[model samples]
Target chain A: MVDQPLAVAARSLFYRKKRHRDLRQRFIEVLLFLAALSSVLTTIAIMVLLVTESLPLFEKVSIIEFITGRDWAPLFDPPRYGILPLICGTFVTSMVALFVAIPMGTIAAMYLSEFAAPKLREVAKPVLEILAGIPTVVYGYFALLFVTPVLQMLYSPFGEKLSEWLPDIFPYELEGFNMLGPGIVMGIMITPTISSISEDAMRAVPVELREGSYATGATRFQTAWKVVFPAAISGIIASYILGISRAVGETMIVAVAAGLQPTLTLNPLRPAATITTYIVQVSLGDTPHGTIGYQTIFAAGLTLVLLTLFFNVIGYFLSRRFRETY
Target chain B: MQGSLAGVRGNIQRRQLWSAIFAIVGLLVLFIAIIVLLALILQLAIQGVPRLSWAFFTSFPSSKAEEAGILSALVGTALVMLVTAFTAIPIGIASGIYLEEYARKNWIAALIEINVTNLAGVPSIVYGLLAMGLFKSALQLGESVLTAGLTLALLILPVVIVTTREALRAIPSGLREAAYALGASKWQMVWDHILPYASGSILTGIIIGLSRAIGETAPLITIGALTFISFLPPSPFKSDFPFLSFDWVRSPFTVMPIQMFNWVSRPEPEFQLNAAAAGVILVALTLLMNGLAIYLRYRFRKGVKW
Candidate 1:
């Protein structure tokens, strides 16, 4: 008789627990769905805000002029809205940054993935992470205080010597805050990004492939450069694109090291303002929102957003394809 | 016959030399990066270490470099991080759990997955603009710690979500099946099983996300956080019984990066030293967070390996 009562009690308790579980699960699932949806909502908001802010600027400045004109004089007396110089500046610095980033990054990635023993990699990774984790503002100060002065000391003499021969072309007059200093520092800033990504790509190359190359009597370098590089081409390209995207969007380094002069010069030895730096420069002055000055930053941000997003999409797809194989 | 043999030997020797050279070059690349890192640390240490003191942590910033301290900026940064974690952790884990477990293998899930990836790549400043429009202009929250924190929470949302999903995926599905078969609800299974297992990694991700947010300057700048706040935000608690207040949330704020940025731009060399000191503090904070994350990842990884 006691056993019967205990069994009945257990049955009732189980039923009640089941009922509570049902309601909790339903509430939690719906909450999670809303949370997940927020990401998409963020994207939509970014696009909508950029478009609404940028639209007014386009109405003021002709789209063709903004794209095609070789000058960017937003704060001038006449207020020329030509963004070509900013675009040119962005390209010039990014090109310089990539020049340093790609070669060094690829080589480092090769060393890390293919050559370094596991112990060495463990030691090296956190060091590289420290570099990667440095705030951009710190990099800005480094560029301004350290890199610029060093470059000036090393290059100004070369400029004076070269002026004897090629006058205009050889005489690369490096300024205190120029495209070169920030570009090089930015390269150092992003090297870990490229190196790590490419390292991942190289790591993903099956060990079998490397052994196969070794079986063919290939040198370590040859095996890595020829076989593993080809195998991970998609990922390497994606990493390059992402690195470029990051370099393009990088703001504070150029703002502090490369002066806020939007110039159409390809000479990285000279000061040139990138789109990001220009935005920072304007934002520093506190241009009231809704003014053309304020809206210009949003426009620049939109341009930056579009440019980075394009590469991000391409990089994403490329990496995805690579991931799908594994 | 002798000449032909010599030519072949020479070619092989040249290839070996080139291979050796390439390996050296690769090592040199890593060396250069290490050197740069050292130079930056040395630079900060030379200028900043002398100024690290109790006063530096206690006083508000001032025009005089000696009088200036990072107290306001430090408090603001801490509060901002707290807010960011509070907003991001729950929502991000929920989103990640939904995507990983609750959502079906359908287009909606795929869309959310892809969108998260894209959102991760969006520039921080664009998020700032969104915050400016949404929080400042539309909602009339004005420039406050809450606005900056919320902006960063949104910015790091993708990172947290991605990390959470990965952590959850690391768990074996056998546990889930056993729980369900035992008549446990989905929430109960997740609460009792999945979360405990994933909590280490989830915490690691949150720390890393906050570390990144702490160092972030552009978004906060874009949202109109002043570089010159001498007073602290209103206290989060008061003398009265309630002991909780939102006054700090409503007040203007400055963060470490913004304060550092302001100092670095000043004309005086003394201010530059102050900037360096603040930079060191910021760097220490970020490095500590990252180190904790790395340690957690390492410890939990070995323990969880089945």
Candidate 2:
């Protein structure tokens, strides 16, 4: 009878410990789940904040006019809210940036993944990372101070001669704060992003493919371009899309170097304002809590978010879809 | 037969020439990119070196460019980073753990993954806008160090999460199996085995995230950080019983990038020099952090083998 009582007491003690451990485990899991949920909450908060703030602006200005209008002077008398000018500026800068980035990034990826020796690759990778790590504000300074001066010095004389020859086409002089400088700097900034991603994709291509091409007497360049490039095209495309998204959303370079005027022009020689630049311009001023001037930034923000979201979604899918199993 | 042989030789020669040309072209392109980077750093150093003295670091901003300093801005950056490190570390690591260790492979997990990816692509300026509405207006936090820190914390949360998950994922499944074989609970297994192994990598990610946050300008500007703050936030240390105070978090602040932006925007060459000096400091700090992270990662990798 004494042995039975001791056995029962030990069993009860074991059960209690197990229950206690389970409770603690459950509590920790709940805390971790809440931590995970914070990201979703942040996303929801962003959407809600943008939408709610933008709704009142929409009530004041029709969505059609907001989208299709050519004027964007929201602070002037009878404020104009057309976003086309900002969009055009963003388009021009991004186009210029892409023109530089796509070719350079692809070539760099080819060199790094296929051609460079291991030691060279190691050195080159960090160089690219340093380029990537430089702050946009520093780039802004470089764009404004160095690149612009060089462009002006080189292009001014030639531009004057060309404009005299073809008055209708060539600009007389590249302005001090033209889009080209910032665009070029932005291109340099984005090169690492594209090259690194595309390099990863190229490296993922099976070595057998390279060997097969070499066996047929293909050179390294030929093998890389013809075989590996096509195989990694999806990832390369995804990188380009991401680059475009970055260029579209870039702020400090355009804000500091590209002039604040929102002129709806396609010429790279002219200074203009992008969506991001305009937001910074307004924010720098003490525009009060609830005004059309203030609300315009949110509208622009919504447009920016949508534009990047579109490219990001496409990129996300393209990368997932074309990821090679081998 | 002679003619056919000659044609084949020409073809081979042309192909070889093209290959040689491409190899040179690729090398040249890489050289140009590196040259540009070197030129940027060189330009900053040449202009800013003379301006980087003790007085520049210790004094406050002045109407005269020669006398202006970055004391308040540096202090603000430190305080804001303090808040950011505290808030982001625990939450980001916990979320990463949940995703990698606990969550079932279901819709919710997939949604979180996609959301994180999308969040990474959202423009930094948009995050600023979010802070303006949610933090400054809705929550009425004002343009304080606390708000800026939280804003940056959110900005880097995705990066931290991704890196944490990557670190955790790199731990071999054999370890997990061994822990479970020992009758360890899921939390016990993660807390004991997985975390210690992954701590170095997680730390590297945190440092990198902080570096990125430090150089950020657009988001901070959008949240309305001042271009000129002549005063510092309240001391984080108190002479009272508790000995620590958070009043600094709610104080107005400025950061290195903003100060640099302010000086760069000025029309005077003197102000531009100040801007360059600030740029040199900011870039140096960022490079230092990244270097430390790289060293930690290399050391950790060398120590661990599956």
User: Against the true two-chain complex, what DockQ does each candidate achieve?
Assistant: 0.68, 0.80
Query: Residue B211's C-alpha lDDT in candidate 1?
Result: 86
RMSD of each: 2.7, 1.8
Report the C-alpha lDDT of model 2 over B152-245, residue by residue, as the tens digit: 9999999899999999999999999999999999999999999999999999999989998999999899889998899988888899879998
Interface RMSD for each predicted structure: 1.3, 1.0
Give one digit per residue, the lDDT tens place, for model 1 in B49-98. Answer: 99889999998988788999988899999898888889998899999999
Flag clash pairs in model 1: none
- Candidate 2 off by > 4 Å: A157-169, A317-325, B1-3
lDDT of 1 at B62: 84
Q: What is the C-alpha lDDT profile of model 2 across A201-251, one tens digit per residue?
A: 899999999999999988888999999998898889889998999999999
TM-score of each model, paired residue for residue:
0.94, 0.97
Name the TM-score of candidate 2: 0.97
What's model 1's overall lDDT?
0.86
Per-candidate fnat, comma-separated: 0.65, 0.73
